[model samples]
Target: MKAVVLERFGGPEELRPADVARPEPGPGQVRVAVRAAGVNPFDGKVRSGAMEAVFPTPLPAILGLEVAGVVDAVGADVTGVAVGDPVFGFADTGSYAEHALATTVARKPEGLSWEHAVTLPVAGETADRVLGLLDVRPGETLLVHGAAGAVGSIAVQVAVAAGVRVIGTAGPGNQEHVAALGATPTTYGEGLVERVRALAPEGVDAVFDVAGKGALPDSITLRGGTDRIVTIADNTAHELGVVFAAGPQQRSAERLAELADLAAQGTLRTTVAATFPLVEAAEAHRLSDSGHARGKVVLTV
Candidate 1:
């Protein structure tokens, strides 16, 4: 199998294309013939050794977290999914390869292309999880920072469809994009507090800080405490008494399926900023690391 292996962790330049042995599924797992792999910020964090303390991977490992592909082999005890199924899920063996291993695979909906399907596992899962954590209710205004990024974009739509008034933060150019997803768009920066205040005059009920770009202090000020503020990007959330929610336990195949169904029904949609061939994994990481891509970066096999 051809894979983008991280010989060492430091920079996107560390990722290199190489011929590695194809992974075989163990018990309760299945091997996927990867069609497209999702590139996440977490993948870059892992690649840079920033998350080594939390998600330690052995050196010379493949570095993607989610994939959309066809099931080529099923391990023992796997029932509902079978070989030849087009599936998308978290890739247990890392997904930056021609073939990867997955434990909780869900059938990819015909309505989604492989690139879009790959985004559901990570972006959708995170959005669903954070919304549950925030307990966002209909009629209440929820503010999301970085509202135009992959996970943030999904969160915006999910909150809106649930009947919540959503205010999302993005760049000036993405204001319309965020608004199109049913959120009142505000630019994130120096005057974010006033901007958000201008939109939600009644006050924000909760703050979901997906961007983590020093929005915590303002969020605390708006909500009167860290009780209603949660962050995924800033490691200093604990210092500010805010909740930092992450890790794989938050995602599941069921959540991915729900997101897929939403996309199939034209309710939830994923933006593909760009797609790179498997060999250009390095370039893909470069874009992801820049943190400026407006949508999910995908790698096609």
Candidate 2:
């Protein structure tokens, strides 16, 4: 199998294309003939050794979190899914390769493209998890920072579908895009507090901080406290008494299936900012690390 392996954790340069041994599925796992792989900010952190304390990666490992591909083989104890099924979800092994292993996957809807399918696992799971943690109810206004971002955009749509009013913050150019996602769009930085307040005169019920560019303080001021505030990007969450959601907890094949269904039905959507070939994994990491990508970055096999 051709994979982009991280010989050392330092920079994107560490990721080099090499022909490594294809991974075989363990019990309750499946080996996928990867069609596309999702590049996330977490992959950049892992590549640069920033997440070593939390998610220690052995050197010379393949680095990817999610993939959309066809099941080539199924391991023991697996049920319902079988070989030849097209699937997408969290990869058990690295997905920046021609083949990867997956333990959590749902059948890919025929209507969904492989690139779009790959985007759902991480963003969908994260958005759904944070919404659950916030306990957002219909009629309440929810504020989402980085609303035009991959996870944030999905969060906005999901919240809107659940009948919650959403105030999404984005750059000036993305304000219309965020509004298109069914949220009241506002720009971050400088007058963000007043802008959000103007949109939600009744006040924000909860805050989902996806842009870690120092939005927590303002979020606190708007929500009147740290209650129901969650951040996936801000490391200062602990000091601010906000919940820092890290890693997966509620990710399941069933949940992924539901999300995939919504995406197939055109209710959920993700923006693919760029696509790179598998050999250009380094370039992909650079874009992901830049934090300026307006949508998901993907790698095609």
Candidate 3:
């Protein structure tokens, strides 16, 4: 099988197209003929060795975090899906290839394109997990920092569906787009804290910061509670009384399935800002590293 393999950790250029042996699924896993793979900042971090202190990848690895594809075979103990089922799940690597192995998989949401399905496993699930941590309730106000990116976009839609009043921060270019997702869009800038305070005079019920800059405290100051603020980008932010949501303890197959259902029903959808063929995985990473992706970026296999 042809895959984008990285023998060493570095930039997107480290991802090289090579013919590698196809991997067979072990027990409790399944083989998928990947149709699309989602490129995320997580993938970029792993590639650049920035996450080496935390999550280190085996050398000569393929890099991708989630995928949309069809099942070609199921391993022993796999029963939720069968061969030929269209499924989507989180794999994190090897998804940039034509085939992938998944320990857990769920059906793609009905009425969703494969490109959109690829965006959900990681970003969607992360948003769901963080929102769950915040325990947002109907009529409560929720604010999401970095509202225009993959996780934030889905977070806004999900919060709105749960009946929470949503306010999200984005650059001026994305202000109108986030607003269309049922959130009052605020621009993140010099007076960000003041802007948020002005909007939610009573303070927001919860604040989700995907930007990861230890910025949760600013939002928390407005909300007046550390418990109400969560950050997915910074793992160490938890020490500051902020919550982190993507480790083994937080990611779950059940939560990912729920987010998929929401996407299928049109209650949630991701904006794919750009797409590249699998062969162009390097270019995809370069674009994502810009930190200005309007939505999820996908690699078609």
Candidate 4:
């Protein structure tokens, strides 16, 4: 199998394409013939050793977390899924390759391309968890920061579908795009607080910050407290009395299945901003580091 391996944590340059042994599924797992793997900000964070304390990976390891592909084989105890079934899921490790192993695989939504399916496992799952924490309801206003990014985009759609009025922050160029996702786009810049205030008048009911650009504390204060504020980007937000709701189940199979169904129904959009061949995983990471991707960056294997 061809995979991009990290010899050591540093920059995108550290990712190298090489021929490695294909991973086989162990008991309670299945092997996926990876079609596409989603590149996430966490990929960069882990590669650069920035998130070492939280998600330490062994050196020379493959580094993708989410993949969409076909099941080639299932290990003992795995049932309800069989060989040749198209599936998507979050793997423990090693998804940046031609084949990876997964313990919890869910059926991919019919009609979705592999590129689109790969985007759901991570970003969609995070959005689902945040929405659950906030308990966003119909007619209430929800505010999301980094609204044009992967997780924010899904959050917008999910919140809107649940009948919540949503206001999101993004660059001026993406205002219409975010608005189309059921959010009122507000500009995030020098005075984001003032900008959000101007748009929401009565104040927002919830805030989900993924930017970790120092906007969360103020965003929550504007919404009137720690209870309505939840952040995924900054794990330190936990100590600040805000919700830090990320877990392995943050990318659970059940949640990805639901997200895929929404996509099949045309109610969800897992926009693929761009794609690179599996060998160009380094380049994909570079694009992701730019911090302005409209949606996910995928590596097609």
C-alpha TM-scores of all predictions: 0.97, 0.97, 0.91, 0.94
TM-score, prediction 4: 0.94
- Each prediction's Cα lDDT score? 0.88, 0.91, 0.83, 0.85
lDDT of 3 by residue, 49-96 (tens): 998887878898888878789999778998878999998887734798
* Candidate 3 local Cα displacement, residue 12, angstroms: 1.7
lDDT of 1 by residue, 1-301 (tens): 7898999988888988899898778899999999999999888888999988877889988988888999999899898899999999998988999999989878999988999888777777787788889999999999999888888998898899899999998988999999999998888889877877788778899999888788899999888778878888988898988999986576577778888888877888788879999999889989988777888999999
Residues 145-251, candidate 2: write the lDDT tens digits: 99988889999999999999999988888988998999989889988888887888889999999989899999999988999999999988999899999976677
Candidate 4 residue 48 Cα shift, in angstroms, is 0.7
Q: Which residue pairs does candidate 2 place in steric collision? A: none
Q: Please provide the root mean square deviation of candidate 2 (C-alpha atoms, Å).
A: 1.1
lDDT computed for candidate 2: 0.91
Positional deviation of residue 129's Cα in model 4 after best superposition, in angstroms? 1.0
Q: Which ten residues in a row have the lowest lDDT in candidate 4?
A: 244-253
The alpha-carbon deviation from the true structure for residue 179 of candidate 2, after best TM-score superposition, in angstroms, is 0.9
Candidate 1 to native Cα RMSD, angstroms: 1.1
Ranking 2 against 4 by lDDT, winner: 2
Model 4: per-residue Cα lDDT over 1-301, one tens digit each: 7889999989999999889887778898999999999999888888999888877787888988888899998889998889999999887657899999998768987788899988888887788778888888999998898889988899898889889999898887889899889889988767877888888889888898877777766876687778788887776686677877655365467767878888888878778889999989899999998878888999998
Better of 3 and 4 by lDDT: 4
